[model samples]
Target: MYTPPAFRDDDKDSLIATIRAARLANLVTATADGPLATPLPLFLDETEGEHGVIHGHLAKANPQWRVPAIGDGLAIFMGPDAYVTPAWYATKQETGKVVPTWNYAAVHAYGPVEFFEDADRLLEVVTRLTNLHEGARAAPWAVSDAPPDFIQSQLRGIVGLRMPVVRLEGKRKMSQNRNAADRAGVASGLAASERPSDREVAALIS
Candidate 1:
């Protein structure tokens, strides 16, 4: 992630928040064959190591887990994003110097990839992940809601992943490069747009 100084977001807590908010993430790993990627719903565990750890599960048929990773796997988390038109910038009317760009927030986490098949650990990971996503529901569900034998059988078809985060990079390109007037113009334009994603970027700018 090549983040300019004005757009960089290195705050540890803020980086973790972005990851948590991005319920789904892309896991990327390189190998002798080629680059492999999987879209996964990963949870961050801040208590684990210096940076933190990530947990998730992949289907047994997914070849990503079987290949030897050449280096630390990267998890990409994306937040609200939108396309910003030059019409949204104050400079567009002044000198027409503004060009279109994208505004968004993202986090990149790097760490050694670890995969395991231990049933107990898998159960724990699944339970915690389930609770995290379901806690807000009126009727929350748990792993125990299913029969033990059925749950055990289901676990056999997937592999558990653990990545102890070694480094993190974050970026929030929310029109911070623009002047106050330009930023305000961008926010107002976005706020008036019908796209929900545009509305989200509007809130960030404001």
Candidate 2:
């Protein structure tokens, strides 16, 4: 994340909020073989460490968990993102110096990666993860809802991941570098876009 001072999000709460809202994240690690990455749906336990702990799982067949990571693993979480055209900038009309850019929010968490396959801990992790996502629905489901033997068998196919965050970095590029007029124009243009994600970026800018 090459974040300029104007676009840096240093606030802890803001960083955690962006991470929580992100539905999917990329987990990356460096190894002797090469760099390995996996897209995962991770959740944070804010109460765990000075920063926080991240929890998720990967398929047992995924080789990422087998390789030893050099150091801390990184989890990349992305929030609403939209492309900004120079046409949306007021400066483009006056000086024709404006260039296109992107507006988005993202968080990167770094921590030592721990992998486990213990049935009890795996079941607990699966249960919490299930509740976190399913809680939004009217008929929320739970891991325990399935037959015991079936759930146990399912858990065997995946490996649990636990990363206690050692550091966190966040970036929010929401036209903060632009002048007020240009920012307002961007907000207006994004708000009027057909993409729902664009509207979300607009709201963040406003």
Candidate 3:
């Protein structure tokens, strides 16, 4: 990520918060054939290693897991994002020098990738992942709700992945480069937008 100093986020807590807020992430790896990516629901285990460990699963049929990655794999997580119109900038009226840009938050995590098929480990991963997402629901569900045989069969169709994060790059481009007046203009404009995501970004402007 090309993050300017004003937009760079090096706070470990902030980086983890961004990752946890992301409902889905893109897992990318370089291979001899080419680059392959899969959209996955990944979770970070902060207790694991120096940086942290990421856990997720991919369909067994997905060739990305079978291919040997040339180097560390990357997991991309994105937070609220919105397009900022130049019209929202106070500088636009003052000097007409402002151009449109995007405001967003993102994190890129790099680490060695490990794909596994152990049934016990797969079950543990899936169970934890399920609980993580479902715990907030009014009527939460569990893996034990299903028949053991059925769950085992389902697990057989997917492969689990583990990655211990070696590097974490976080960017929060939320009008930090703009002057206070221009940032307020952007926040006001975004807060009025119909898209909920825009309003979410507006809250981060300050």
lDDT of 2 at 9: 91
Per-prediction TM-score, please?
A: 0.97, 0.98, 0.99
**Range of the 10 consecutive residues with the lowest summed lDDT in candidate 2:** 1-10
Which stretches in model 1 have alpha-carbon errors above 4 Å? none
lDDT, candidate 2, 25-138, per-residue tens: 999999999899999999999999899899999999999999999989999999999999999888988999988899999999999999999999999888998999999999
lDDT tens digits, residue span 1-206, model 1: 99989999989888988999998999999999999999999999989989989999999899999999999999999999999999978888899997899999999999999999999999999999999999999999989999999999999999999999999999999999899999999999999999998998899994
lDDT of model 1 at position 33: 99
Instruction: Write down the lDDT of every candidate, Cα atoms only.
Output: 0.94, 0.94, 0.97
Q: Which residue pairs come into collision in candidate 1?
A: none
The digit string of per-residue lDDT tens for model 3 on 1-206 reads: 88889999999999999999999999999999999999999999999999999999999999999889999999999999999999999899999998899999999999999999999999999999999999999999999999999999999999999999999999999999899999999999999999999999999999
Error of 1 at 47 (Å): 0.8
Candidate 2, superposed: residue stretches over 4 Å from native = none
- The better candidate by TM-score, 1 or 2, is 2
